[model samples]
Target chain A: MTDRPTIQRILTGISGFDDIAVGGLPASRSTLVSGTTGSGKTLFALEFLARGISGFDQPGVFITFDERPGDLRVNARSLGFDIARWEAEGRWMFVDASLEAGEQTPTVGTYDLGALTARIAHAVRQIGARRVSLDSLGSVFTRFADQDLVRRELYRLAGMLDSLEITSVITTERDADYNGVTRQGVEEFVFDNVVILRHVIRGERRHRTVEIVKFRGATHRTGEWLFTIDPEDGLVVIPVAFLAPRDRASSERVSTGNTELDAMVGGGVFRDAVVLLIGSHGGGKTLAALQFADAAYRAGERCLFHAFDETRGQLGRNAAGWGLDLDVMEASGLLRVAATYSEVASVEDHFLRIRRDIADFAPARLVIDGISALERRATPRTLLDFVIALGGVVREREITTLFTSAPTARGTSPIMEIAGITDVTLVLRHIEGPGTVRRAIAVMQTRGSAHDRAIREVAIDDTGMHVGDPYPGILRLLPDAPVPPSDREE
Target chain B: MEDQPPAALTPMATYAFRMYVAGRSRRSQAAEENLRALCDFYLPGCHEIEIVDATEQPALAEEERILATPIVIRKSPLPGYRVIGDLSDRSRAAFLLGLPDSGRPSPEGQRL
Candidate 1:
């Protein structure tokens, strides 16, 4: 790559957003903020202005339509912004054109935004503002019957702000039926940069995502990066860089917390490899993962156990019964256990929480006790995208991760899907014969090693686990044993 | 212009009008002229007219919620009124200003 002059950026101060933007926004330019109602477009704009004023020493003006400046101040306060103080201190200016539609408003002739432009110019001058947000342009532009006139006015407004050297964020309402970023499609044409906010509903949950549709002079990460509006933090962007690729591969390996099981996978799992342990409910998947946790802790490495199906306390006690001493590891700060139900938060929020934990803990070994429970929280496609994102995050950090999931009767589940992307796969199942039941584990696939193929009877006890030799003879009495008769016919 | 407040005008005019106009636009200039003529004929010496150039003073326009150009507003007389466009039609302009039908001159051509 050749050296290129870097485009100057104004840091938005929103968490994780700068990473996806490769920095903040391009300075002294307009960025279009488009989304349907309740998708947090207004909040995004407010947060940008608030952050600019408070954090970057950049004063701003908020020109609004349909919402009064007083009400906006109140709403912003509820979101933990003290815009009222900023306005009082003359660091901010709010120009409201929301009530301009009624008869009380001054009526003017066709294609005249002279008054609006003058008011904005006066506000920018009053505060010497570096940032400006008009939330929104749709309500204002909808007053026009002429599309061409609206387009011209929008271009003129952008140019006006550009001439003042103020970087502005102009919000435009997006309709559910409309295809373009803005309601009129004029915003995208006028502004050099556009950012789209989407609220995707899965079941009863709304997953909020932000995507930069276009950035004129910069190369941006092209994907929908996740974001959530915190009542206190305002807008938090989950950067795509968390999943960006690593420069070089590491050949290090870590134990699975069991000597016999480690040997079965040819001297334990490789560093940075994602291992999937597929099993039915209560098929010793958690126990196998705990063994890996124990090994990691014993190696003096940090471990993070993110549990979806069980409580952290329950996991601690369960590991204690196996003599793994997870409680002691946690007490020593060698291990951290966090548990949350998937239904409590949207899939994106849950990912953010997990990402936060990973960032704070910086664990070398990570284990998600159950991914199937997370899958239950979202649609198949949503879950797939989330898992892919999660996989990317861990893979980039070169963190060895173990995820457990229950297999369907057809051997299909999130585990099966993740197994393809992961480096190793371990399938665990219950073997039933007449009136007896036994647990068996088979190494389906393992990267960087010659893994065992034979299914083995895995025994778990207080001392740990024992991997018994090949149980091929016992498969005759089990259902779907050794590929069954259908496989032979096919 | 300020010294001569239009001959035959009374000091206690009941009706008050403010016409908002952009700079030298043909439509705005027509609206301003039409508004002055309408007031001169209808209210005669009983009304007051104030012409505000929106281009020169946009902050006032924004404060008044001006969306378009060449708009006439009747600020007094209890409920305010707004008229969009050039205000060239006499009857429509009369209706917007809440003028009585008899406010117009007869065929004999009465002057203010």
Candidate 2:
């Protein structure tokens, strides 16, 4: 670590926010949070104070200029913040500067917001507050006619807060999503740090992101990071790509649930490996996933199976056809099959739900069947982010995960992008013979270990998947024609 | 223009006004001076002025939702109206506070 005098920070305690903020807002300094309407600017401002009071025992004063204290109190209840109780406990205070409905105050000549500044100082002193939030300063700008005067008074207010050694969040509104920093175009210049929240409609879905524009003598992660407003947890930023790679790579092997597939992958896959199963509709991807889950149950370990392409009933019927009793495994508490339509929610919500399930069940193995079905609901970039984030979660817990996807028509499939992050990849395809369409399987990559490099025929009977002898002269027929050197020896 | 006041005002009606200020600042003093002059010229003996220093009485200012300093609230004579800023423009301030117009014919031929 450099011995430079880095600016001190106060942890906001917002989920996944501190990771990107490099700690939190600069200590005892004001930061501007600007956003468009309904872009969660108020929520960010409220959470900054709520979390400070609850998580850090820091009292705060909320100076609301647009919303009343009662509305804020009621709205905060949905996010598990008891503002009334905090008020009763002398930890939270509100300086109600919100204008009454239809009650306009006409200006005569010249004035200053000294009354607001005095009330704010009084509230801060009453509660001994160390944190203050002035939400949506745009209302003040709209209330007054002179922009320069308002800007000057707000600048003085910020200076006073600094002298009080109070860390503050002053929110402002932006007219458009990607315009200047604020609606007034001067609010950002008054503060040392600035954060912007954006809500963009992409492909008929709302994608929320937060970015740290500048920190002024401080360091922070630069970019737009995805976030979702959870009712129970408030605004949760999804810092997926920023997660540090897991340092400990487990070398112990775990079975792939199929004897032939295990032999093909040099005995088995690593214990904490993320495996990708790529195939067509009828190429036995679901069967491999089911067998993998069954093997985990047989080993007395818990498994979570999430299905997007099939319903639970259909999956149960398919498992019965393969002579595996899914109900019995579920009854034994070793297997859980959760099936849902991918279009029911955004990919980020699905990710949060899966994360919640993993935390609740603590499974040792996970199987996500038909991730490509989710691709229909999200853009390729979001889908790749989902996979990367999911990879980070499973690998952190050392839970072996298997993700199945149907091959895309184009050369650059979303699955191909995911393959780069997965520890193992298995490709299945239907090879056309002279009179019959036969299935073949190939182990494309195994991160640490390797074994057979042959195109082997795979057959499925009433019993289950069965691996047969190697299929010769099949390299040229495959798409992309990736001819392995071992085929020459044969 | 007729110099007659609007029929709504009665000579016996007492007008009550409360002004919020920030201590003895220059703007607050200017507002006080302008307000006294306006009241003396319009409703001389019928006006009651109560001055509140918001810096010393923040809770009262908060209760009144006072954001800017040197604001005057017309408390009585029904229908309360709030006017912000230091009241230097006596004619406009008189009109906004619903005071009886001064019998002075000026620009725009309107009674001040």
What is each candidate's DockQ, to 2 decimals? 0.28, 0.70
What does candidate 2's lDDT look like per residue over A1-490, in tens digits?
A: 1212668888888877886887788888999999999999899989999999989999999999889899999999998899999999999999998888887888898999999999999999999998999987899899899999998999999999999999999999998888776889877776779999999998777899999998888888898888899888888887652255467889888998999999999998888999999887888999999999998999999999999999999999988989899999999999999999998988899888998899999999999999888877777667777887788788888899999988743333566768878888998878888799989998878888876788899999878898888987736423453334233221
- With candidate 2 superimposed using the best TM-score fit, by how many Å does residue B108's alpha carbon deviate from the native? 15
lDDT of 1 by residue, A1-490 (tens): 1112566778888766776777778788899988988889888788889889878989999988868888788888886778888988999888877763353433333436656777788788878999999888887766666667666776788899988888888888888613765677666766789898888764676778888888888767787766788765577765444444457666887788778778888888889888888787877888988888877888899999988888877887888887877768889998998888877887767777777788889999889888778766665545555666677678778888998877533336434556666788888778884587877888888976798777898777787678887875746312233333233221
The most accurate candidate by TM-score is: 2
In model 2, residue pairs whose N, Cα or C atoms come closer than 3 Å (at least 3 residues apart or on different chains), thus clashing, are: B102-B112
Each candidate's interface RMSD:
3.5, 0.6
Lowest lDDT sum, 10 consecutive residues, model 1 chain A, at: A476-485
Quick one: best DockQ, which candidate?
2
Regions of candidate 2 where Cα sits further than 4 Å from its true position: A1-5, A189-191, A245-253, A259-271, A409-411, A433-436, A447-457, A466-490, B1-15, B43-48, B101-112
